[model samples]
Target: MKYLAALVIALAAVPATARPQLAITFDDLPAHGPLPAGTTRLAVAQAVIDALKAARVGEVYGFVNGFLTERAPDLPVLELWRAAGLPVGNHGWSHLRLDDVGAAAATVDLDRNEPLVATLAGKTQWHWFRFPFLAEGNDPAMRLAFRHELATRGYRIAGVTMSFGDYLWNPAYARCVAKGDTAAIARLETSYLADAAETATAARTDARSAYGRDTPYVLLMHIGAFDARMLPRLLAQYRRDGFAFTTLAKAESDPVYAADVDPSLPPAASLRERLQAMGKAPAPRTDYAVELATVCT
Candidate 1:
């Protein structure tokens, strides 16, 4: 679940009685890497699914890398989404942040990611996309140009509203044993919930909040082992918070948002490159904020 960190998060300020619907999404599709628990991405994803079940998660969107999907074709994660009626989309082939490279490079990255996603899903519909990092800058022109490109090729960009910096605590197989961080998993869960609540609180209070009365809060996460490790508690918290989870498609279909199927900014890149390419990023934004927008459930 490696994603470059950046944020283009747009949280609208809205009334408490008019709280927005929320959706949770995970990225680093086809995490076929190793984990401290000696668990593969496959094992971890299944654990996440089980946790979602225990937490009564209704829908999940997995943004997969095309190459990883090819490497681990047997991963049951995709099928889980299918059986559960969840949607699937592309993250990219190598999880590269597209903003770092030149236009040609970005084009190459998008071309590869899109087809891989099409191949994995075996579908020709308007599949959504989650940038490796939410690196799209405030340059409306850049974003519009990218969107037009995607529209030409057939892709819909999934915009995110909030993130809890989960990827920073990715807790891959190696990290798990490195810090003997059993509690790290629990910490990750609690911390993410807190982030969500904090964002919601801000939206509820701020005069310029990005949330609205009819808008649903959109939350972002990842598909890493650490994420799976903490998902049970996370879902429990969502239920505890009185959130009735639903699929991205259903949420987008609702009046809570005006969904579109156009493409988005340049391709994705690593976090550093995306930041360095940050010509017009907002003030004091975390990498998670940008990533959340591009990859939310």
Candidate 2:
């Protein structure tokens, strides 16, 4: 009877089709800016943590910028994130763009954040590195060189497969709040949630085209006032779309990570661009900046 039970457990592990999976990751941690009036950074962090807890998310990673920690040491923001049992990775010291700063300078920026994360993470592994502005380098040679540097430092690149310009809304939302424009704020909320759902659909389409199956997806978001407010609903919508919350490690375990070639570009070549380079046509993404401009003005 024990043997039969063990066999049943092993059989259940096999997949007929990839279970729809999504891993949430935040950039510009500790503080991301455009804070609405009357909102403290700690308050923003708590709101985000509460939303994640309510969603019952397993693991959501936050990429930290060391500069922010130095500026806001009084606020135990990183401590709050650690208290929530979430792992934080390096997002570079000043969030400098690799293409703009060059490979050598960028490596130094990463180095600056290492000690900070080491201290904050304690016994936890802090080996993931995300590119600022998603800029790798100006060319393939530079890109590979930086990649080698990361490898030498025992760091894995945190690649993102899903994002819908969620970062663009914070400043606009803050503006609306400052002006007491309730109507514009309402419009921003409605559009932001709808765009997030559409972006998830677009990401899934790219995965199907690229790998003929669903790849565990890494979603890029920011630590911002607006993001904290919307995350709960956004996650609920993802559940309705058949996705299960997952860890960054589990999400990257998909074979696509090992096989997909990094596109030859300087910086900010999104998943859609990468898919297009591989000869797959992905759906168009909504222009968040343009949409925000309408309400912001």
Candidate topping TM-score: 2
lDDT of each: 0.57, 0.80
Candidate 2, 1-297: lDDT as tens digits: 554354336434536354688889999988986788998888889999999998899778889998887775523999999999999999998999988877888889999899989898988878888889877676767777787678778787788889898988998899899999999988888989989988988888886675556778889999999998888888888888888989888776654553122222123345566678788788767777876865656
The parts of candidate 1 lying over 4 Å away from their true place are 1-19, 32-34, 69-85, 123-126, 137-142, 172-192, 203-208, 211-214, 253-260, 263-297
Per-residue C-alpha lDDT of model 1 across residues 1-297, encoded as one tens digit per residue: 121121122223323443345678877765733466456656777887788767666667778766665655544666655565555776756666655653445557777876556655665342776777766534555555655666677666666655666665553324545666666445445556676566555433331222223355456787776677767867766666666676677565432233243343344332233334654222243334543332211
Q: Residue 232 of model 2: what lDDT?
A: 84
Task: Report clash pairs, candidate 2.
Answer: none
In candidate 2, where is summed lDDT lowest over 10 consecutive residues? Answer: 259-268
Every model's Cα RMSD, please?
A: 8.9, 7.0
